[model samples]
Target: MSTSVADYLLDRLRAWRVDQVFGYPGDGINGIIGAFGRADNDPKFIQSRHEEMSAFEAVGYAKFSGNLGVCLATSGPGAIHLLNGLYDAKLDHVPILAIVGQTDRSAMGGSYQQEVDLHSLFKDVASDYVHTVTVPEQLPNVLDRAIRTALSRKAPTALIIPNDVQELKYSPPGHEFKMVPSSLDLTWPQVIPDDTAVRRAAEVLNAGEKVAILVGQGARSASVEVQQVAERLGAGVAKALLGKDVLSDEIPYVTGSIGLLGTRPTYEMMRDCDTLLTVGSSFPYSQFLPALDQARAVQIDNDASLIGMRYPYEVNVVGDAAPTLQALLPLLDERADKSWQADIESKVARWWETMDSEAHVDADPINPMRLFSEASPRLPDDAIVIADSGSAADWYARLLRFRGHMRGSLSGTLASMGPGVPYAIGAKFAASDRPVIVFEGDGAMQMNGLAELITIARYWQEWTDPRLVIAVLHNNDLNQVTWELRAMGGSPTFIESQALPNVDYAGFARSLGLEALTVIVPDELGLAWDKALSADRPTVLDVHCDPNVPPIPPHATFEQASNAAQALLRGDAEAWGVVKQGVKTKVREIWPGSSS
Candidate 1:
């Protein structure tokens, strides 16, 4: 029997143990999708509503499930659409393989409708890009290596297949594929560095008057290791938005997140710390980092590129955080530094004292902080929250405070839009015990194929388990970024400057048989939330929000500020030049030990 190149692609994915594949298909991918059906014992293929979301869904699935997420897209505009989400997978080091279908090989020069140089386009985003030219030489070892790079480095990799390859007929007796294995030899230190650095760190930590440890995404994979370091140091642990899973709030040292959406106490403790140690956290929020001169700081991470890349470090200890801490814990002089830890704890106490007061509630529409607070009380402590780009980040930053019981994934450095629902799907598949909560903006949701809700429904069909999940849409009908751009001295009227209207998200959800609902205020929130947690079905909650909500990313545009000062003669505000100086300040504070 003869097989097609499309069949071989499906075989490779199966060999890699991939169970689900995501993407939307146009004519360019028709042959491939057709070839990969149940008749051939193909791995199940999932059709997402948007190309970008498919990319995100694939990455999130790979990240949580510890398996490859395979996504497909047609070339040209379709391939281009994959970049934003693909960038997120690369930045976060999520293992995903995007198989993009190109225009027929012969149409490469004519700029055919679906024609694009997918190889060159994906070079920066993927670990490697390979296209099947002839069928016989389909290197399985090479295919295996692509997956390895993505898994090992926490990056996205690509496999491009042109239409010709997909349609080509191949005879039996294909070359047998030999698997490639992980090649890293651990002959060197399994840990990060020598005992000298750890001992010095322990000494400073033991002597500190106030100590706070800021955790970041780098610690996500080593949550246990990070927890050990915090316990031994007797340091209070506060996380960046991405570090929510490291230490649960139930744990003594695990406090809230620090930043615009963070608890003020975490910020206060960081500022008050006599010594602050950052563990695997390149937390990129400068607005919350402590004064560099106030504390002795040390950083631990596996990637050297992250070291001293943000702020100056009093001590740069480059090694594995888990082993390094285990070695340091025993070497330390066991003298307790209770008062310092106590003092920072006191500051947190004060901040919490005011948190519940009228300040936490707001009537102003689209206040992300207030929205998160209200949503927080309604959400399951264990639910995973996937936040999208734009003002949605602001809401998650302000409102999505993680109790130790909860965990989720959102944008950090390469904060792009449209990953919310798709990421939520991935997170759900990764850990099925808890329902996934997707907090998305109206502008963002339109970009992802909400039809992905169908994928969830299909997988959990027959109401077999009764899926209890919903994508909460914060629908504000404007790019809203126009406000930021105007503040940034850029015109607000650029392309896609405004969000489209007449979007009936609930209507769309209903069509898919998803239990869709919408919330208009704090009171209506509980019903939807409670229902999601109680049932075994997927849901979509589309809530209308005020378009005036501002971004949290220090977006006071210098140009706007200058004009405002000239017109209002309001020299009361600081100069834009001063704010510019703070970019490096923000960079260092969040990326301690990194160069600006």
Candidate 2:
């Protein structure tokens, strides 16, 4: 049988070394689905419960694997469903290629069923590249460029294939004038800034007494270099949320995550630092950084376009983080006085103690912070952790301590919910030998996580190490937004919108033939974690936690406190519980050993 456009597409993806494509089925993509069957599932099609989950799984795979992630969908509704996750990829700067099917070419202009203008819909999210394949000759070049652009730009790209065109006979571009042919091989170049910029950055660091370094996901490969530079300059390191796994928290000088979900030491260090060295991080909260006039700053990033925008820098070096820091290391003079670093270390120690005290503080049943705290010490060295955007992220950011080869991430820039469970699925696929863990809130779990649990039950046995623990903070509230409404909007928690219907998350997991554990008290958390970790298949831990525990910012402003007070006066349903928990949690910070 002669090859079809759909067959050739899969062949090309396989040539690019793509092993899986996450997607859902639809009539618009029937041709491709048929081709997937004919190809004997080469470059396997991993079916997700929804198109949105497919895109999110692709994002997770790309983020953890350091490769191009691909997702597929049918026309109109399926394509539209992919937007949120694609935007997540775009915002987080992950490389993803979304292959969407469109209506038959003849029915397109006549507005037949599912005949939506996919190009306009995808234009912004896949701004780097979004094209419609009208003919078979356009196949290889368009697909190759989409793959290359997504990889090079670290952004999402798209290809809209008409259903009729997908069924057409495959044809290669001719050797004539208008035809373009493409290659499968691509090698990324190591980019480094010129010598002059490196020298200037070094000079600024060498002249400073108190130095602070900030890192993001882009500095993942530069861990050793970041540490070396920090040692030479007597700098304290602060990690952006996306860079949480870049450095081990065990390092005395390494402050935890920055911004709203950050450590107190990080906030204090940024407030007092005389000089700043930002490496591969685009942390958006400038208020959390040093005062504009107080610190001389230098930024190093691979993308010149993103540099020099977040802050005014004395020097902007366009280079890969590891090599750039390596080059700057030699030029930097070692600091003779270690008093500044000593102070930072002391602050870091105090911050951890405070976090511990807060985690152990009394709650109605299970303290949410204690879940992450217990997991931190018990996490496998090769674990891959993922957190959804909610109160779960608050505790994950503050309580978890990443060490050894443990890697953790979430929808950092997007801060979207529902990716926690799907990301763990993707992570498990990305590294089958590693254990994966995910923190989810009750809201997020109900939104889409419950369905993705079926996806896990379907594939968990295939994995070499069958440990995927889903820890659900079953607080029956949209805890993050509830707190935001009170603290930011000065409005009371509107129970109608904030309250969630309680569901048996563990029971649902057991129905799917996976291990299920329910924790209602603090003492059950550690043992539940152990059982889940040792389970033969995927496991779910549904812990009934207090919804009133406030996720206090590192440095709370007077205005925010006033807003919370106003919200309480306005008759928040959980006002008394909020006041009680907030006081107890805050008291831990003031006196770490005090049991209030």
lDDT of 2 by residue, 1-596 (tens): 99999999999999999999999999999999999999999899999999999999999899899999999999999999999999999999999999999999989899799899998999999999999999999899999999999999999999999999999999999898989888888988999789999999988889999999999999999999999999998899999999999999999999998989898999999999999999999999899999999999999999988899777899999999989998999999998998999999999999999998999999999789999999999999889999999889988988899999889999999899899998988898899899999999999999989999999999889899999999999999999999999999999999899889989999999999999999997998899999999999999999999988899997989999999999999998889999999999999989999997
Which candidate's lDDT is highest? 2
CA RMSD of each candidate after superposition: 7.4, 0.7
TM-scores for every candidate against the unseen true structure: 0.80, 0.99
Task: Quote the lDDT for 361 in model 1.
Answer: 33
What TM value does model 2 have?
0.99
Q: So what's the TM-score on candidate 1?
A: 0.80
